[model samples]
Target: MDKPKAVTAAAHKLARLICSMLTQGEAYTDQGQVCCEERYRQCVLNKLNKRAQQLGMTLVPAAPAAQAG
Candidate 1:
């Protein structure tokens, strides 16, 4: 497998692990102070962005907010 493929696979695996942890309630404490959701989100996003960069893809900017009428 090539570097890109390896990176993709690793990223996917990491995402799945994070999801499992969250779903199984293994990611946070009762008081919600130890929430892992945000950390997981950032980790996945960072990995995806890194993979995109490695594949020569441009990371798009966040969409603009809509104005309420």
Candidate 2:
């Protein structure tokens, strides 16, 4: 969707979350940037893996880089 619709949809989601938290008497805790970034990375990887499996292929993790001599 376009920017306006996307913003509205996000606002609705945030409102619902806030409402649920209030009803449960819970506090809102921000999962810092690192946590959010890691979650997003995992989500992308999961989607990529699923697509690869559908194509009869597998994803292999890259080897750690070697230090310069």
Candidate 3:
């Protein structure tokens, strides 16, 4: 019943986070992209995971990359 609503809420939050990150290009290194620390990743994931849990949902884990021969 409320699943769709929950998903929508979480999606909006996640989208905003992504847009914010993308717009932070000026903050990135002049030579390349931003050098994020492990803590930053953990922080973002943790926050979104918590939000999802509150909404009775979970973020899907990314599939592993294929290996070369």
Candidate 4:
């Protein structure tokens, strides 16, 4: 089966995000850094929501995966 366009677009976005992290990712301790972290997190959530809508799906946080002993 062919991949859905929405998923392909999301994959492209995620790939770009990964590249950006490689160049800009770092731990920082400051108010501005904390705000930036929240901003980026929300931006990703927005993208996911958009994609989910496009695919006629709902988006929700998943429960933590169970770990095998």
lDDT of each: 0.84, 0.97, 0.80, 0.86
- What's the best-to-worst order under TM-score? 2, 4, 1, 3
Q: In the order shown, what is each candidate's alpha-carbon RMSD?
A: 10.9, 1.6, 12.0, 11.8
Q: Where does model 4 exceed 4 Å of error?
A: 1-31, 64-69
Clashes of 2: 0
- lDDT string for model 4 (14-69, tens) is 78877777789854335788889999999999999999999999898999999999
Query: Which window of 10 residues has the lowest lDDT sum in candidate 2?
Result: 22-31
Higher-ranked by TM-score: 1 or 4: 4
> For every model in order, what is the number of clashing pairs?
0, 0, 0, 0
By lDDT, who's the top model here? 2
Per-candidate TM equals: 0.41, 0.84, 0.40, 0.45
Kindly report which residue pairs in candidate 2 clash with one another.
Answer: none
Clashing pairs in 3: none
Candidate 3: worst-modelled 10 consecutive residues by lDDT: 26-35
TM-score quality measure for candidate 4: 0.45
lDDT of 3 by residue, 1-69 (tens): 499999999999878877877887534333433435666788999999999999999899999999998
